[model samples]
Target: MTQHADVVVVGGGQAGLAAGYHLRRQGLDFMILDADTAPGGAWQHMWESLHLFSPAEHSSLPGRLMPAQPGETYPDAGHVVDYLTDYEKRYGLPVQHGTRVGAVRRDAGGLLVEADTGIWLAKAVISATGTWSRPFLPAVPGRSVFTGRQLHTVNYCSPADFAGQRVVVVGGGNSGAQIAADLALDGNAHVTWVTQRPPRFLPDDIDGRALFDVAAARRRALDAGRTDTGGLASLGDIVAVPPVRAARDAGLLTAKPMFSRLTASGVRWDDGSRAGADAIVWCTGFRPALSHLAPLNLRGPRGHIPTDGTRALGEARLHLLGYGDWTGPASATLIGVGRPARDAAREIAQLS
Candidate 1:
């Protein structure tokens, strides 16, 4: 039997929930299909020590402000999970948990959303599946020959797992900085942090809120047909969160240039310097999880579904939300996703 809805939202993460909030306001009948068995989306899987660079109040969805975690300046992953769980219930969003969507294709009537649980025919489809599941591990030479344990940001849980081992942390982003700091602060691992370029840290005062403002300003400029202002890229790469700041000041978080290639036991640099390692943690980031939409054959040269605002150019009835700024400025962040979600919902409603 095919379920029917005006809109079928894939992925019950922050992006999906934000879209749900707006869809409800538009009085559109919709169903959210979540791959996870529980609420909290990807936040549930983040490392135990992971903390948001912004405080709870500043990191939130469209309708509700995230409650401040008692005695914590920046709330951890667990706190975010709790907030997302609560937010979903508070809005009474109709989410079908554990229903993993397999593919999205055009239907004679509308769009067909084939999932493990069932098939949904919806007038519009919102692909809000964020990138957590698609961790990207770059192909460095000799990577396959390395005998040491290798993991990506998604597999990381705690520094204790790698304690007393020589671990190499790769990538220049926030995850790389935080994980390296976590290992160093644990005081048990011999940690070497490496990046393609020298790690750039945002000013100590900068946080998610500041980054969002910069993104918004850039968006306004772009809308006004002004020159591109670089947006968040104008700011440095890493946010100097408390843990990272402490680790940097203590010289425990210094990043070396990325290694030239992996050795059987560890890695080697262009300078011929070699380091032995028990494990390598790749925080190289992720590609958009858009495999479900492959049947559409809509990807452009950059491997992105070309879009005007949130609406897909290849398929007008489809909206791509929360992949990144290409969909909307700062659309991937907690606070930043709201505007894009609202705009997407509004557009869907208008089209309906």
Candidate 2:
């Protein structure tokens, strides 16, 4: 039988949970639909070595703080997964786990959410589905002809898989840097880091919180009708986490400009030098996960549904949260997502 809710959240990660927290505060009935069989959201899929760049206190959702684990300066993926699980229980948030949302379309009543398990008719729909499900890989020439393994960050699991192999890790973001470091140190792999531009590194002391503050300051400047520099640090600017610092200290963090194209066996540099590689790990990042929203035909050529604040521009009852800066500045991060989530929830409540 088809069910219904006042609002339906399309993701059960930090963003969706944060939305739930605020929805509950407004005394609204909503259900979060998660694709994962268990808790943890996308964190459950990260490579085992991944850890939060920020400390525990700085990486929390609304209404609850993630407790610091002993001896863990920064919580790892497992800790985050556990925290997300606990956060759901602690707040008593109603989450329909394992129900993957297949589509969301507008009906006469409101929005109809079709999931793997059942259908939900909601007065409002919050699309908090983050980008992890859609990993972006650049279309380099000869990419299709390459014989070696090619994997995106979403599929990357551990360095052990690439041990004793020469692997080219593309992208300058934290995922590429962290995975390259892991392969170099833990798996004895010869790793080459490649980026479109030189990777910028924040000071060793700088963390996620500092970056968020910079983003906020830039946002405030923009709001005041002034020029915004977007701060000296961006979310993509690599943080000096312990492993990254260690990699730098060992001279393993050097970055090379992006290769001109992919060759049959490896990549060819702009200088015409070719390196034989057994595998290529692309950390090029992700596009927003809006396939479910495609039925609405609201996406532009860039695959973005334009928004005014948290509300989707064309579809007033539809809200987009936690995709990235386009949805809300710093919305991709844990602490940063709460602002947009709260705002979206309040807006959804008003509609209800």
Candidate 3:
């Protein structure tokens, strides 16, 4: 027989973990279903050499300090996994790992979730799968004819992995910028990054300290519909700078505007330019994965759920975390996910 609970959260990343914590604390029956073997979804999948821009103190979760070692810059990818693992052991949070959700449906009474492992019925479901599951790669012309290995930055593990090849990286976001910097410093390959528009880089002293406060503040505003950023502006694209320009000044790399087509042995630009390289890395952005949630009535076009005026997802009974520029402050931070989670749990409690 299928297990029943008061709530069932999909995805086991920070959002899901905090949601689970809130539900349990409120004495609500709930379980987390995760696709990975453990928590820390994308963090665990980061390129092996990555270190978070935010320091560990800023990366802390609901009730735990990520780590408080001075002189320790933000954590490497491994540190993220370690932290999440500790979070599991720390709280003994009940999570079912490696369980692929099949679908989520609503009946007269409540939500029913089906997964590869089994079926679960709950009063509500929290969709915490942030916008990274499906990496959006543009349909470049002649892409199939390219006679080189092509990979997304999402799959990149380290600079050493591309030690001896000419790499063409597409996209100007944080990921592409950092990857280009890494490959150039190692003297491993000729790195050419492509982004239509260059970003504004700030001074080192600026610190760009946004991890905690932004996450915390946005959570309350997003849920209450009183976010100060106003309408769609609240969810505008957010970019954080972390000393990326220093790499640009070094002669090892240069960024070009993106081209529209791919050739058998090189890339072609829209301005009628041509760049030949041994490999191509697409650094395109991400979108949320909620195709499995069609039955749940959770989303509209482009994967945005029909939340109540962008404040709450549908009602207070359900809450969306880490969506829309991570604008709902508390919902976005490692330390802040709890506030919204707690509020969501409280709202759920009022439901039954």
Instruction: Provide the lDDT at 142 for model 3.
Output: 85
| Clashes, model 1 | 0
- In model 3, state the lDDT of residue 169: 86
Query: Which pairs of residues have clashing backbones in candidate 3?
Result: 215-329, 215-330, 216-329, 216-330, 218-328, 218-329, 219-328, 219-329, 219-330, 307-313
lDDT of 1 by residue, 1-352 (tens): 9989999999999999999999999999999999999999899999988999899999999989999999999999999999999999999999999999999999899899999988999999999999999999998999999999999999999987997899999999999999999999999999999999999999999999899999999999999999999877778899999999999999998889999999999999999999999999999999999999998888986678999999999999999999998899899989989999999999999884
TM-score of 1: 0.99
Candidate 3 regions with alpha-carbon error over 4 angstroms: 69-71, 211-245, 251-253, 309-317, 330-332
Error of 3 at 95 (Å): 0.5
For all candidates in order, the CA lDDT equals 0.94, 0.89, 0.72
Candidate 2 accuracy as TM-score: 0.96
In model 2, the runs with Cα more than 4 Å from the true position are: 232-236
Error of 3 at 351 (Å): 0.7
Best-matching candidate per lDDT: 1
Between prediction 1 and prediction 3, the one with superior TM-score is: 1
Model 3 over residues 1-352: C-alpha lDDT tens digits?
7889888888888888887777888898889898888677778888765777677877777788888545557667788778888887788888999998978877666878899999988888787877667788888898899998898877887777777787898876678777777787777787888876754443343332543444445555766788464432233222333335457666544667778889988899878888888889888888767766777565666667766422345544455666544424535456656666776777778786
Candidate 2 residues 119-192, lDDT tens each? 99989999989999998988789899899999999999988788789899998878888888888777578898
Q: Relative to the unseen true structure, what is the C-alpha lDDT of residue 168 in candidate 3, on a scale of 0 to 100?
A: 93
Clashing pairs in 1: none
